[model samples]
Target: MAKKQSNYAYIGIAFSLLVFGIIFIPKIVDRVKVGDITRNESRSKKVLTNSDPVVADLMYLEINGVPKKVPPFSFVNQDGDVITNKDYEGKVYLVEFFFTTCGSICPRMNRNLVQIQNTFSDAEDFGVASFTINPEYDTQKVLKAYADNYRMTNPNWHLMTGDKEAIYALANIGFNIYAGENPNVEDGFEHSGNFALIDKNGFMRSRQDDFGNPKIFYKGIISEEEKEDEDGETQEISMLKADIAKLLKEDLVK
Candidate 1:
């Protein structure tokens, strides 16, 4: 009787151990799988950090192995002809928002854009487009004058103007920048002086501020201090120029 009791106790102990192992093993495996997934996601985020903040975010927005769609736009160019999204279907473009009478930073931005045009003059895939935030003031004639002032005669370079509301909507909502009437109403319409790089597929890949540096613009927060910087004269065009080159080079590889 005593031997039987001892045997039964041992059996019970073994069964308990087996049951515990069965319950805990799946949990352990699940934990390992979750850990692996977390590690891969972290690695991916790290890999996306590059010179262009917008491009860096684009890594997460890719669908079917390509960046997401770029919104369509319609505006009048320097020539007074209507330009639409269809015209830019197969071209990669550098886009900027500016006004002809912007005494602070518009000239510098145009100069930098001219430099970009010169850099990619031989590349048939690349072009430049500037949309006037003050469309009422920057009519086709005004944009034409502005383009000529910058010596921008490239058939591909388009200085554009359109309806006031349409231009404001594009600046604020489309490109995700600030553009509206100034509270003081003395400084004209307030809009970001940043250049956006759009790929051939029409995805906005990058944005660089007026200083021609990608580092100046953060995705979510555009600092008031940065706006002040745009108001000042600064010669830092090399950084933005390099970003354009990088984008072109990457496109070439694909």
Candidate 2:
């Protein structure tokens, strides 16, 4: 009877180690290989160019057939510092819009952003930024508290709040994420649930479909128009990271 109990204990220890390895091994291996993620993507080592067709409509204006560089933007970060496109020059960044009081998808979206931050927080060429739709409520002090809650102290990770119209304008015309307030909605607000990938030159990250063809994810979101998916957020964070990594590997750095 003692021998059987001892065997069970050993099996339990082995199961615990297996679970631990399953949970952490991939993240660790990914951190070690972070630099190589982009290189491992497409077979060609050729640098990305403006001429490359964008994967999303409404992300950029097309002069001919290529995605045009978005104009510079301005906002105030949690620390109350003004941030502009000039602030992100030569950096590959991810962007999103959320409100502090959101009780649903925003939390999950933030979790994904946190993962993105953790994955490449140390990469000089990479950064993450989020804009608050509720600027009136998400003051610098409120934003600071929210950032603290997330333990987001990296100088490169910016949680920003500014003029409500200004934030909405940038969301509508610049980043393509929708921002608006609707009384009918449970939270009296609506915004896109996407995490947009911006290239070093400020163009949204364009991607190809499974057959290596350009596929537009979305254009800018307008008021009274919202997209809902039964699958919730369909795009994978891994794919978004790979897109960012691909942009990092681009030759557009100044």
Candidate 3:
């Protein structure tokens, strides 16, 4: 009787394995084929293809009925000034996470930001807050040199750095942007090439898509002139520029 029961148990285990193979093997193969199993890229980053229509009033990003607000933060900028969210209370700004030594996407992201900075050169209320993910290596002196290299002349464009844990929290938790270190990647770091738009009064803002969903963030990897990236993602820099202009015109709440 005991031998018979052991044989039955072995049979049951075999049957369960067969069922799992039939159900999950194909799905796993499909995901692998579609490049969804990548280790070098951020899974949280949304790819808003260029063809998506961008037409809607700038909407406040809300969660559970309350408008999302920029979380409080304090860091030293490239110029060695203590900057905080309060400094941008009445100003419209873009936020991004990048490291100075990044060779892949950081260059393109900063270049596009510089263009936007030039476009809004006259709007004193328009600004940019760039936080470094690798704060250990991106000191104030390093960020200052990088700012000069990129011609980031806008007085409001601050390349900031501080506590590594605090900066990571600001990127991953505070802003919901992806930025982390991974030794497997080329630069030993990975971050989303996306920018968050913040409106006056400290609320997060973005343009709605054709489907009436807030885009949430703009693609920072592609330039306005590029039309589309190599992966077929359309450049939203132009859209971003237009939206920034719109936000600049909004009246500050008293």
Candidate 1, lDDT over the whole model: 0.67
Which digits, one per residue and each the tens of the lDDT, describe model 2 over residues 1-254? 99999999999999999999999889878875775456635545444534464333223434468775656778889898988877877788877889989887777677667767787877787877789999889899999998898777567778888788888998887766678999999889999877667777777656666766544342222111123345453446655666666777665644
lDDT of each: 0.67, 0.72, 0.90
lDDT of candidate 2 at residue 56, scale 0 to 100: 30
Residue-level lDDT for 12 in candidate 1: 100
| Number of clashing residue pairs, candidate 3 | 1
- Writing each residue's lDDT as its tens digit, candidate 3 over 164-234 gives 99999999888889999999999899999999999888888898889997888999999988899888999
lDDT score of residue 224 within candidate 2? 14
Alpha carbon deviation, residue 203, candidate 1 (Å): 0.5
Off by over 4 Å in 1: 1-68, 183-186, 207-236, 249-254
> Which residue pairs in candidate 2 collide?
55-216, 56-216
Error of 2 at 85 (Å): 0.9
Error of 2 at 207 (Å): 1.1
Evaluate residue 100 in candidate 3 and report its C-alpha lDDT on the 0 to 100 scale: 95
Give the 10-residue window scoring lowest on summed lDDT in candidate 3: 47-56
Question: In model 3, what is the error at residue 237, expressed in angstroms?
Answer: 0.5
Residues 81-184, model 1: lDDT tens digits: 88887677667776677788888656766766776678778877678878888887788998888888889967878888878888778877666657777767
- How much lDDT does candidate 3 score? 0.90
